[model samples]
Target: MKQVILDRIRAALADRPGPVAVPREYRRDLGGTDIVELFAERAADYRATVTRVSTVDIAGAVAGALRDRGARRIVVPAGFPDAWLAGADVEPLRDDPPLSYAALDAADGVVSGCAVAIALTGTIILDAGPAQGRRALTLLPDYHLCVVRTDQIVGSVPEALSRLDPTRPQTWISGPSATSDIELNRVEGVHGPRTLDILIL
Candidate 1:
């Protein structure tokens, strides 16, 4: 009976065409808009707090945000750019140490840089580079501060893919981690940070 039911469901979708494709002509005319605007709009749609600032103010801005949020100690991935956290006084929780569930859960926040950002999808891709640390560093913290440059924001997925080195490990984060069960109700932080602060410079 189970096999019969599964076969029926498969047959129902067999004839449906794949996702709609755009014509080449339409693709050619994909005029661009201001990247900062696109980034903020899409990030908001994904439920992330998006802040725009000049490169010079990055350190002070980051420190203020963390301090205002009452963060006592924060985690910094081993290779994260130094400028982002220069003014932040919180203890720097290095990613070199083994990451246990308890250690991550006890930390106040985490800071890191991204490999790229997809403006169309409001997604940030981490290549597990020095800035990204191990996957566990980002996953365990309650708050995450992600610094992405305007130059790194690509207009489309194809553009983003071209810059990413496929041979390396990567993590694509659209927003705070979330999930839902059979009821269709939504829940956040089931697996990762509950608050995501995106700094676009």
Candidate 2:
């Protein structure tokens, strides 16, 4: 029944004017600016803890970030590397069996890799890729430790969008979830993790 109404709406709009072309007026001219530096600066402005680390020290960095947050039970999404969690003293909670919401909420944090990150907006995109698990894994936890490689950072939103698979479930996060709508008082963790730790490797 719901499908019938949607089909009727689509049929009504099918002939409603021609497809419109969107203007590309946004700035794309990043004249030799260091994107990584820009991304880190912008992400930090969003209150995310951004740490730049070499590939060799990624495991240590991840461990330290979790330790700093006192995250004892970290959600280990499927396909997340075991090597990355090697130095961390936390219990690795896998999503293979699909943990309950209570379990996810009780966990200290989550650590996963991103599909792409937009340097212009300081946004990270996840697509439930091998490193990224289901959307719930990242959302239910109080903290998130994201892994963003230098190569995955794009200069513009269009560039980032073009690189992603449209069929996949995508989550675009500019920072830890926040809002100032309720009584205009700024609040964090209302929608997502309160603390977002970014590991830029």
Candidate 3:
């Protein structure tokens, strides 16, 4: 009886129409708004703080962000720009072999550069690139300080995906780690950073 049913299912599928082509045209316009500004606004909607600064002052901005959070020790991926943290007074812990779970938990924060950011969704993607460490680097820390260049901001999700490598491990973060589970009470830092501060350069 199972063999007979399987044969009928196959015959039914064979009679279905071919798939249709999806339309490629969509809203790709930025509506005369600057991509970086749009991204900052969308990020704020998700409760993530954004600070826009000049390229020359990025180091100062990074330092100020960490200082405000009182983060004494910060972890960074190997090959991270030394100059970015030069102004910060915190101890820099490089992730050479990647930190163990306990060590990351104890660290005050993690700072890294993102692969790409979406202005429409207010999402940041990390592909383990340059300053972006391994997956665990961003996940285990309580505070995440991500530096996003103005060039890295895109208008939409499709634009962001087009710039990323599909095979590489990617982490997409919209806002601080949070959940409305358990009686719908909102909780932060459940699975990732409770505070996400974006330094827009």
How are the candidates ranked when ordered by lDDT, highest leading? 2, 3, 1
lDDT of 1 by residue, 93-160 (tens): 78666667788889999988899998878999999886888888888888999998888887777778
Model 2, 1-201: lDDT tens per residue?
Answer: 999999998999986987799998887646688889999999998989999999789889999999999999999888888888888899989987899999999999999999999888999999999889999999998999999999999888878888999999999999888889999998866769999999899
lDDT of each: 0.84, 0.91, 0.89
Candidate 2, superposed: residue stretches over 4 Å from native: 1-26
Per lDDT, the best of the predicted structures is 2
- Which regions of candidate 1 are displaced past 4 Å? 1-30, 97-101
lDDT of 1 at 58: 93
State how far residue 91 of model 1 sits from its true place (Å).
0.7
Instruction: By TM-score, rank the candidates, best first.
Output: 3, 2, 1
179 Cα displacement, candidate 2 (Å): 1.4
Per-residue lDDT for 52-169 in model 3, tens only? 9997999899999999999988998886799998899998887766578899989999999999999988999999988897888888889999999889999898788789999999
Native-to-model Cα distance after best TM-score fit, residue 190 in candidate 1, in Å: 1.8
The estimated TM-scores of all candidates read 0.81, 0.88, 0.90
